[model samples]
Target: MEGFPEKGIKMGNMTIKDIAKKCGVGVSTVSRAMNNHPDINPKTKELIMKTIEEFNYVPNNSARNLKRIQSKAIAVLVKGIGNTFFSDIVSGLERECQKKNYSCILQHVEEQEDELDIALHIIKEKKLQGLIFLGGSFSHPKEKMEQLEVPYVLSTIRTAGENCEQYAAVSVDDFKESYKMTEYLLQLGHERIAILTAPKEDESIGKLRLMGYAQALKDKKIPVQEELIGYMDAKKDRYSFQTGYKLTKELLKKTDFTALYATSDTLAIGACRALKEAGISVPDECSVAGFDGMEAGEFYIPSITTIRQPVEKIAKATAELLFDMIKGKEVPRQLVFEGELLERESTAFSSCHESVK
Candidate 1:
């Protein structure tokens, strides 16, 4: 009766007994009403349900399952599988799980795979206590989420087309952060800036960042040039160095710009390689910037400028939030972290439109 209130269970934590008193019925009658017992009056059951909803009485459904002794475990579902940035996050989650004495199961969800369907299957087959979803554009409906009964956390994801009540999330605000990076580039006097980003079809982080980039240019009265934007090749990895390198190489042949910004550090590094090959000195002939402050950026010949997301903190917080929800002590919520803009060697001040000279 922990959830039950005192003084006929009316004032504090609500119990079935309180509900029964409010309905002017016996405890068995209230139980019957809640359970949809055939013996209960239909109108009486409907009244009880309304009261339950009004009072927000949630029954502990896990009590029965908790009795079954199973090794505690949680699942981490990664979309885009092997992306290096996610590797750090996944490793962090694994370590956190170890500290909590819980097992971590990682499932790499393919770009085309239906993640929710896969998650439902895993939850039942593995009997996981909780779940952590990494990467991917989330588009599941409330129904789809209900199917995933266990509490789950979405890390580094931008969810669309659904109510957020179904899950908790940990990530930087993609739009504002992207805008910050773009504005930084603008402030450097780079007028004709080009962006190497994800495809037109991406509805996730890529889309948000792209919009932010566009907004930054607009605020500065610079018309967003379609030719300056390089949408990722459908055939290439969206966040890969190869994609960045190829796009920059392609851009060099077609347009002129003083600055180039890639959505990820890996892509930015690739851009640097392409620039070096073309005899264009970084921050001298062409400035560059990237998102995600990966360690590789720090060591690159011309250390890359980037927005550093707090990966370790986000990862640990993700696990803690999910575990708290699993224990019925917390509710689903979104937590956005601030990113640090590190102006490194790869970018420099340039007053004139250098073009691809």
Candidate 2:
């Protein structure tokens, strides 16, 4: 090094040679001191470390992690990050990941197809350790996930198809939950119970939920009326309040149902609004209930009776499954949770008829 300093190598703005000269030591001594070598004096090592900090020395994370061979970041892909349902799940996921010293990166792919593409890209490019698929169904075929060879967990409200055995999933027993809700309404002396649900045959959950509604009526010896069933495509709006509002308005004009079981809280809330505006009393003129005990449902005028899914538990279980898969542990292919019915002011005895007019 021309005069041992002209090379311009610096540590904390002081050239390595300058540090060595200042400590009355050789360049080897300075290097050892900076690296905290056992041969270096404690005072020298402290001075070197302090100088590095004072000068705002930055280490390259990529280079550092290259030595570790693995990243601690996990990727989360969902339909919409703004949705409260997804937010609650994310909260649970973050809690679990934090405890395990892993960072979570959330990505919202509005389209299902796009989400599949991104998930594949993340596995190949970002080298993500694991992925958590939240809310919506995967657009790609189940085989694609197996082909990509990545650890993933699905936390959608619905269960996956038969081909989705490679990944783990957490979902509620939609059929049993919906059937129980319908049975409860029927037990309350409701004969004309209507179901607002997404199209059947789209997935097991949707079809099973609708089946439960139909079965409950059939079990009680009530004839199944095709007119009482409202079908929407979850792939299409998935039962928004506006969807509920419009559908209920139409249903009221077409049929006189005594009770309504909406597939989602948003739909039920919309239904309630439409009924109130039409001078129809809730639980009196029409007993209303919904799935997914969302917080907004509780504060709605008269509140909403709903089947409450264990969203947090689902999230936690989903994360744990993915974590196990990431660590090369075998997990169950399907994990199903039960839902609880939260009876509230929105539902009442069939005889409690208080006219709004």
Candidate 3:
């Protein structure tokens, strides 16, 4: 194996990747060896540790050493406060923190606020051991992330390309789940399906879900209609019931469709109310579907058809991962959970198809 510099010499520029390269092992293997994961050969682990010691390299500035301050506190930064879909996930995270005997701080972040900036300030103010970002568009420059001294996890947050691998994340594949919903509607013989989604410039989950909807239509030989796509007003909208109702009302003016798909269950409920006021019967006159299997959707007048995300499971995994990262036991990785498509009373076979029958 290629050896690094002599002991007692500080290699300021050395990194974990560099050490892995010298050992001729994969980055994950190097991580496992450093963390004593028990799966690696004892001889290999010793060699890796020796190499690390020789270069005087520190992984993320010595995880255990940073825990010396003894602050058993963590913070959860939640964006889009009014969205009910995040409630369970937040609750689960808090419970996990409690089980670990750590204090959990929940902070709401506004639409325009920078979560990272807030986190940096809070980390200093509260002396947090670690943190988790609950919901937001997390697309920050590496330099900005490097400023975060403690380990953190992204829970139900959407990150841009290449940037995802740089940190640990727990979320569903938005594009795939959206495509599944769209395809379900399509399979029910619904054409000209309308979609209420994020703003036109959204680059996070909104963009992915929108792309999925479009792809499903194209595959079914249906051309995507511009008027059928409802874009939320990001500056003024909070992904709340009012936003969905307002968007649906506006959509009602310009076009007609057999089915309407909302990106969230909260939006789906609002859309149903708008359709009801407009003298439209859900799943009879028109079909409706939504994402996020929130509790309100189940108890609504017409139970909403949605994509059920495993929030509790996701929360447990996120806590485990963040704590593991803090203890120098794991590396940053993306964990995608599958979303189940729940067919409920809100959506049915398109009436247009029934007319032909």
Best model number under TM-score: 3
Clashing pairs in 2: none
TM-score of 1: 0.77
Report clashes for each candidate as comma-separated counts.
0, 0, 0
Q: What is the lDDT of residue 328 in candidate 1?
A: 93
Please identify which of the two predictions, 1 or 3, would achieve the higher TM-score against the true structure.
3
- Cα lDDT for residue 285, candidate 3: 84
TM-score for model 2? 0.76
User: Which stretches of candidate 2 lie above 4 Å from their native place?
Assistant: 1-61, 67-70, 80-82, 111-114, 137-140, 164-166, 233-236, 352-357
After the best TM-score superposition of candidate 1, give how far the Cα of residue 103 lies from its true spot, in angstroms: 0.2
Winner by lDDT:
3
Indicate whether candidate 1 or candidate 2 has the larger TM-score.
Answer: 1
Pick out the ten consecutive residues of candidate 2 with the lowest summed lDDT: 1-10
Residue 338 error, candidate 1, Å: 0.6
- Residues 87-169, candidate 2, lDDT per residue (tens digit)? 77888898999978777888877733566778888877776788888765444566565665677787855553666554577
TM-score of each: 0.77, 0.76, 0.79
